[model samples]
Structures are given as structure tokens and as C-alpha cells.
Target: MSLAPILNPAQSGRAGVPCSVVGASCLLAAASLLAPAIAADTVRDRDKAAIRAAAQAYQEALSRGDGPALAAFWTADGDIVDEQGNTLAGRKSAADATKPAAGTVRPDMRIRETNLRFLTDDVAIEDGTVEVGLPGIAQPVRGRFSATWVRGADGWKLAALREDRLDAPSDAETLQDLDWMVGEWTVVEDREGRPEAAAGDKPAMEITVRWNANRTFLLRDMKIPAAAADEANQAGTLNVTQRIGWDPLSRKIRSWVFSSDGGHGEAAWSRDGDAWVARTAAVLPDGTQTSSLNIYSFDGKDRCIWRSLPTHVGGEHAPAFTMVMTRKPKGKTP
Candidate 1:
């Protein structure tokens, strides 16, 4: 994931900004209640900037693997308590504890400050999220950290710091990203509101997508006129049943498809920004194997476009095509 700054640079320092600290309840009383909040917040902003700058300094020290510099950020008797309940007490102990990481590959550290409030004029409490990008790890290690900063002659220092690891979402829960597919839809002309195909064109395909009883999976049933597709290449009504669910072994969202004819296939789904990409592999009744990459792009709440790239069948290639699907009205008929 891309990294964001601790805070936007434009947010700090309200110096020279115009403000009318006046209200209906007398000017003096209103000023008394409002001016201090603005003043206190300004002070907090300066403190936050100082701490942020100090954090950057420590980041540089970490890159150099300088254990002493890292220890200097804490007070002489500072305490670092980890999620496992282990403690690194005092500046010396902290320095010694980090000796192992010295001269070794260090992970990239990122901080996102959430809330900061001054306990007193010289001390403040901070809460934020921290992510460390470790070597050999595809995803960063994410966690929440709370730290108490004490202001001494040397400026703000970490007095006590604690962090806890966050749990990753389950595969089933991750499937919720495609929730918009659950609905009734029918193929329509890509140019206009409804189907207006030229005479003798392939018939529209009607589809209904819904959730299973427990809502863990989605089931989609669709129909295509024999003119569009038929089993055994014969003229007969063609129907397709598709089941979409999370695959735990592969850790991906996958769909299994079965047509009226003796053919079956499955596709693994992935998202690329606003569009979904499905890598599909199928087998026909005649033992011919096929593969294609299908892209689904939603136009709006009630419209979507499904486009299939070139397909490789046994030894031949099928041209690509695009089709628009519009959600059918709640109570409508063909």
C-alpha cells in the first residue's frame, strides 16, 4: 500500500488566519469560551509537528541501524511493553534489546497519527496506526500503538509505548466486496436505455443473481436463446447455472459454471480498481478445452458491462465481444 504523510502540511499553524470569536451570548463571554480552544489547538499543532519531526529523525536512525540513536527517543526510565507482555525497561535495556536488529536488514516503518491531546502543557498522549513492511512478507504487519510523550529539557520523549496486532479478515468476509452483483438483470443495447438490436440479432440473455440461504455464497441462473448459444450446437433453449463462493485453499473468490449441455468450468475472480477480472477455464462436451479472460465493469447501480477477451479453444481463437446488462425492474416482463 502507498504511504501517507503523518498529517497534511497545510493543516498546521493557524497564524494570521481570520476568525470572528463572537456569538449571540455577548462578545466577551463568547471570546472567553472560544479563543482558548483555538489557542490550545494551535499549541497542540506545534507539539504534534515537533513529535512528527522527531519521528522522522528516528526513522533515519532506524535505517542506519543505530541502536543508541533509537534508545535516545525514550526517557532514561522509559518502558516499552509489547503485545506479548514482554517489557524492555530503561534506555540501556532498550538499546541492548535492539542490538540483534543492528547490522541486519531493517523493515520499513510507517506511522499514521489519529488523535493527540495534551495532558498538561508539557506532556501529551497519542494514538495511531503503525505498519512495518518486513522482508519476505507480501503484506505489511499492521497494528495500533498508543504512546505517552513527556516533554523534558531534551523535548518530547517516549515515556511508555504499547501496541497490539490486528487480525486479518476471513476469506468469506472478503467476498462482500462483490455484493453489488446480487440482483436481477437482462442484456441490453450498449448505446441506449434498453435493447434495440437490429432484426435477427442474438436474443438478450436474462440473469438473476441471489444469495444462498446463509448468504455465504451467490447463485446466478441465466438463459440464452438458442440463437445465441445451444448445447451440441443445436437449436434449443440454453440455460446456465453458476455458483460463486470463496475458495479457502486458493484464497480467492471462484465461480463454477454448468450449462444445459454437458459442459462445465470454473473461474477465479480478482478486482482491479473499479473492474473485476475473471480467468476462466472450461471444457466442452466434445472434450475441447477453452480459456478466456472476462472483465466485468459496472456502469451504475442498475447497469453493467461484461466484455470477454479473445478465447483460445483447443487450437483456435474466438473474437472478443462486449455486452451490456441492465437490472430488470422489480415487477416487469419481456
Candidate 2:
């Protein structure tokens, strides 16, 4: 007697079916069933990429101050809930609210995606950080934003956007206003067309700014190799260690800088139009008191021009000089 399980012809509606034939049929059925699932996964991944692209477009529009372009990222009836709880309903309202005044400095806004979840093939939820600042603003506005994106005939559009202001910025949050400076930068003295370059070898300054482990402060280290070679002057190799942080007591952004040459100074930083103005006072190693106004203007993410106007130094005022710094690519040694 063969001890094999018999196939029920009544269940399969086929009689006298070979086991091999049954196995092949089952495999074919599974392939047919999985094909649609595989196709669906591919479609979902494409949709996610499209949605993220739309988010980037939205940020670019904001940075360009193009209110219409910004609005086009949203659905016709889309709504925006701002940090103050004011709602701008519909595309027109949202666009008008965001339109910059004539001649106003464009806000430098950056968006970083934190989370993205697909609710359906055509719908998704995105959470991100939005940091915005104008040239003269002491600190950029930092906020959290959550958006609902929906896919339609025209691709993904924001169905709703809600922004919430972060509680009074932590020490780290304020430092984030200068986050663009968190990198290695080099100043090529001769290339900058400055009069100081007429002197031999024109000193080059390398600056490195980095965040501490907790990111509460930005540590800046600046080195001028030429300064060290000046044997006659004790200022040996100008190395300055600086820390930038938010001072809660003063409710201001400040920086303290100490140089290897026994020079120490502090600056209160503020925004002035499209520039950052730092009013600085320092005591030189020779015990001479000095004061200056330093203005920093960013040309873009990688380059900034800094100008210093001396107000007092040895009781003599001096002309302002400008220095430009360009960011060095990561992992590149100066």
C-alpha cells in the first residue's frame, strides 16, 4: 500500500492531475500574485523621491523670495498654519503672506528633512526643520514644520503645512544661526587683492569652526602661520581660540576670542541688514586698548567677506580692510 496523501479532485476541480503539474501551477500562481506587489513598491519609491523633490523646490522658492513659485508647491486649497497660530488658507492667501516687501532682503531659509511616512500611494507626511534668517537679524528663526503631501495629475503638492516655533532657543539653537560657518575656511591673502599682500609672503589665515559634542557652542580656531615667524614681535603664530554662544542673561549672541599673543576680546553680535555686525573690544598683548566694528557678509554658503573698521586703537583710527574666506571641501587639509 502506498502511504501518500491523495489529492481531492473535487477540491481542485481537476481529476487525475499529476503532482508535478500541480506544483508548477502553484508556482505560476504565486508569480502572478507577486507581480503587482513588486510594481507597487517601485511606484512607492518613485513617489517618495518626487515628494522630496517638491519639498526642495518649496525651499528654493522661499529663498528666492518668489511667492508665486512657493505657492505653486501647494494644492489650490492648501493651508499654512504659522508659528503664531495664524492660518493662511488657499494658495493665494499663503502666497500673499509670504511675498517679500519690495527691496527687502531675501530670507536665507534652509530645510532639513527629518521624517517621511507614506500614508498611501498618493499621500505622505513629512517633518522637517526650517531655519530662516535675514542678513541683519541677530538670530535666525528656527522652527519645526510638518507637511502633508498629496500626489495628483501635476505631481506632489503640499496639502497643508504647519510651523511651530521652538521654545526660546537653547544655547545650541542660537549657534545654529552661524551653522553655515561650521567648516574649514582658508584666506589666500594675495588672491584677495588686499594692500596687505604687498608685504612679503602675505599671511594666510585658516579658520576651522566646529560644533562641540552637545552642539551648544561653536568652537573656532584660527591660525596665521606668518604671525609666528615674526620673531621681532612676540605675537608668534597668531592662534585664536573662539567660542560663539547665546548669552541668556544678555539675551544676545556673543563671541569670546583669546589669542596666543595674550590678546583677548569679546564681541556682541547683531544683524544689520544683510550683514552681521560685531562690536568688538580687545586689549592687545602690549596693553593697548582697541575697538572695532566687524561686518560679515556672506556671498553664498561657501564664501564670506569680512570687513573691520577700527574705531580706536592706540588712540588712532584706521581705514577698514576686507578679507574674504572660502570654505574648503571636507577632508581637505589646508
Candidate 3:
């Protein structure tokens, strides 16, 4: 019987072969050619899933600066070649990398653009870039890497890692986000049209912001008219000078603030959506420590809102205050 009717029973109603022998042979040959071949040398599907799990764990450990945990991701004799041509092997390979070197702050490694291929059932190769979020250095560094991952009795482990090139982006470009803050601003009514300068809450504030000569720092001078909010402002018109700049060592935008009444503090600035939040850690003239969250958000080019939410002040909870700030008219003096 011709194989055509047997293979494709609906081709003809007759049970016996209805096609010619040559046609049956051609159909059989075509079906054979379309058959999938399972290669023994290729990676198993389960193994690929395991490798992905290990990669995720690897990134998590590296970010938290957990040295011992990072070391566990590698094989017993695994090694790494850094961008500088230095080689480290075994536990030292993972442990040493997590240690923040000089000029680096919290060098967190994140693998990106990963391409994984199986060399064999038990071995895989991965090519990607490792972006290190090292805050203290001025330049942002990205290192291209090729890693060898091997499936072992326990699980997948990194057998070798090589970082060949390092690319860096200019640090100044990162500071451009704050350019909108460089202007003179004075207090306005709150966002809800409520006055923030209520009794015993906050004084009226006017701030003039300008860029330093190098354009690397923001110079802000604030004048507060004497009010009942604090003893310092009640004595006279309080002047507060603050210099905000990018600190390469800390990998943060840092500000140093000094008040006319001898109160001084520093804050690390970070972005939260459309707002900039500064967590200030300050000490009063009488040696009392205080901390507050200062949030600055914008409505447009000419107006913004500032909120001082107190977390701690002399071991008591002080009321949080909010105010709207309008940009002063050009060439106008207060």
C-alpha cells in the first residue's frame, strides 16, 4: 500500500493507498526532513532556568556588598580578570571585588545586555556589560565582560569572568537635573492657598540661588525675617548660607548649611520623582541634634514648593511645615 493514505488518511476516502508510489515516497521524505533533531550536546531546558536564577542571586549579593555571599556564586577554582589586567582566583575573586576601592563608593555591579549561549550541556558562556554604580568617582564606569558559567552538582556557578574594557560618562552631565533650582525664590501661600507662616510655625523666607564660578556648585543664601518660630530668627533677621555640590567621594549631592546663629548641618540630596529630597542632619547652637526631610517640588519654571518634615529635633516631634516659593521677577530685589 502507498504510504500517502496511511500518513494523511483524509487525502482519500479509500483505505488503500490512493496516490502513486513516487508521491508517497516524496511525502515520506518531506516529513522526515521536517522532523526535529534533539542534540545531546545542547543545554537542557531546566539548566537554562537554573542559570538565570544564579545570575539574579549574583546581582543581589553584589549590590548588598555581601562578600561571603558573592563568593558563593563562583566555583571552587573560579577566577576573574579585572579591567586593569589584574587576576584574582577562588574566594578572593568574589570577596575582593565587593570591597570598595579608593575613589569608589559602594561599587555595585549590575549586569546588562546579557547574551547567553551553551557551549555544552554543562557549560555556558555569557557576554554582557557590568555597570558599576560607584558613587564617589566623578566618571560613571561601565565595564564589558564575558563570563563562563558551568553547571555543577550543586547548581550553576561562575567559572570565569573577564572585564576587558571600561567606558565612562562625564559626571557633570548628571548634575544638570538640578538646573531648574538656580533662581531667586520667595515664599508664597501653600499649594492649597493656606499661609505657612502661622504663629509658632515658620518665618517668612526669601532665597537667592546662583551657580558657583565653575558651575559645579549651587550657592544659596536665605534670609528669614524675625518671627516667633525660633529664638535665632526672633533675635534678628536670620541669614542661612548653603552650598550644594556633587561629592565624588560620597557619590551624592551634598550640601553644607550654616545659620547666623551658629547652627550648622549637612544634607545628602536625592531625587524622588519630580521632587528633590534632602535629609538634613543638623546640630543646633546649643549642641542639640535635629534631622528633617526637606522636599522641593516644582509646578513650573517660576514656582516650586518646599516642605520641612521633621523626624527628630531635641528628642521631640516638631510640626512639619510647607510653603510655596515663587521665582522672583528678573532684575527685582527683595
Candidate 4:
């Protein structure tokens, strides 16, 4: 995301009046008019940074099980609202609630700032995502948090904090469940033959999955080399990109796919027992609509199986097919 430059109103003048004239009284007036706004902006930026640092410090304290240190980041009268909608008033109460039990391991926590809105130079509202990983839990617990920050002699301090546990799984948690698939994988064997292979085309397929820089989305890319002359003259080959993320509006795990062959798809994913399923609908270049249910099962970290049940295509149903995928050997090139 690119931000537009913050223009100085003093230098830009007001109401189309020119302030560049030599010894112009209008220039002084413009400068006077803009001084408070400029100062406020500067203070807001500085406070935002301070509040973020304070949040990070609190996270560290939590990781280390330092209840006192966590309390130090808050104002003397700061309060906290826990996920269960219970309020712990006063910094001491908040600190006591954060303290880990004796001989217990502290949960690892990571915070990502999402928004900061300044109501005044001395106060601001902060929103962030919190990910917590506890011992014996397969996946981290994801939640959202909001805090009211105040500027005092010690700089920004959390005056009030509220945490809410998500009733539905977050995109990060959903993606993390599939993190085992983050690697290069190849189709080692196909119990059912590929569609192109049945047409006497020995096409090759490769798949790679990785996380975006912020680990907010899983990006999967697949490529199949053309095995026929007619297909070669078209798009370089069969290339598809899939992005898996949490859809806030749908409140579900969703994916969008785009292909070089002018095909695109949208899928809503769900978990069934040990397998993950994606119900997908795609539109082809020729305006044909196709729908399929794809089931993905994991054998282990290195092996998985995929089954595609084509339920509808141009008003016709197709048989289901399955394929096995094995993680590419480490240090091996394709």
C-alpha cells in the first residue's frame, strides 16, 4: 500500500491564494493556521510508535511469564477485559491474571498491529491480532485485541486493554493447519490416469506451496508442461495460482484460483475428519461452468493424497479420481 505525501498546508496556501510572494502577510497567516495541525500530526505519529513499542514489550513480558513487567507497561489504573468477558480492574489485577501457574510453561505470543486511531494528541486506540501457542496444542489460538493508550510522564501506556477470542477460526489458524504442505511436491504416482494422459499426452505436473512474507496467506502455484504442439502454441503451459486466506465476510476458509488458460475459480474449504475438503466452482474460457469437490488427505509430512470429484460440468457429472503427491526430496532440483 502506497501512501500519498503529507502536504504542508502552510506551503500550499489556502483558497487558491499564493503565499510565495515576498514579505506576504498571507504567508505568515497560513503558517500560523497550519502550525497546530502539523504539530498534532507529529505528536500522533510519535505516540503511535511509542504505543507499538509498548505492545511489543508487553508481549515479551508475557512470553517470559513476567507479570510485573507486563503491568509496568500499563497505567497505574489500567484495566483488562479477558476473552470470557470478565474485567480485571487496576494494573495489579491485570498483572495477576497474566501470571502463569507454578511450574507451567508460558504461552508464546505474537502481536501484529492492525490499526491505530488517534482521538487526541494524548490518547489513541490501537487494534491488533494476537496469536498464542500453548503447550500440547496442535494449533495456535488466534484472537483480536484493542487497547486504549495514554501519554504520561513515562510516554505511552496502556490505559485499558480488551481481548476477544474468535468464535470462528481465523484465516491464520486455518492456514497454519495446512502449514505441513508448505514445500515442493510432485505426483509420484497416479492411481487414476491424468485427463491429458488418457488423450496420449504425457504432461508433467509440479506443485509448490509457500507463505507470503507476512504469513497471512498461503500461495500455491502449479505448472504442467505442454505435451502437444497445439497446446504449446497457446499459453506457455498450464499455470495456475491459488491463494488461500480467511474471508471475513464469509467467515470461512476460502481460496481463489487463476489459470493461464483463462480459467478462474473460487472455493470454500472445510475440514472433515482427517481430510480437508474444498468445494470449488470454475469458469472456463468458453464460458462453461464446472464444479468439483476436492478432498486432500495427509499420510504424513512427506506424503498426501488428493481426490477430485467432478459433480457438475456443463450440466453433466464426471467420475471422481485420486492422485498421490510426495514432498520433493530436500536439496533435489526439479
Best by lDDT: 2
**Reference-based lDDT, residue 150, model 2:** 90
The runs of at least 3 residues in candidate 3 whose Cα sits more than 4 Å from the true structure, single-residue gaps closed, are: 1-173, 189-203, 228-233, 312-316
Query: Cα RMSDs of all predictions?
Result: 23.9, 18.4, 15.1, 23.5
TM-score of 1: 0.44
Query: For model 3, how does the per-residue alpha-carbon lDDT over 37-97 read when each residue is reduced to its tens digit?
Result: 3333243666777888888887776555556877788888887655434355645535533
Predictions ranked by TM-score, top down?
3, 1, 2, 4
* Model 2 clash tally, residue pairs: 5
In angstroms, how far off is 39's CA in candidate 1?
82
Worst 10 residues of 2 by lDDT: 310-319
Q: Cα deviation of 296 in candidate 1 (Å)? A: 0.5
Off by over 4 Å in 4: 1-173, 192-203, 228-236, 312-319
RMSD of 3: 15.1
> Who is ahead in TM-score, 2 or 3?
3
Tell me how far the alpha carbon of residue 83 in candidate 3 is from the true structure, in angstroms, after superposition.
32
Worst 10 residues of 3 by lDDT: 310-319
- Per-candidate TM-scores read 0.44, 0.44, 0.45, 0.43
Candidate 2 regions off by >4 Å?
A: 1-173, 190-203, 227-231, 312-319
- Two-way lDDT contest, 1 vs 4, winner: 4
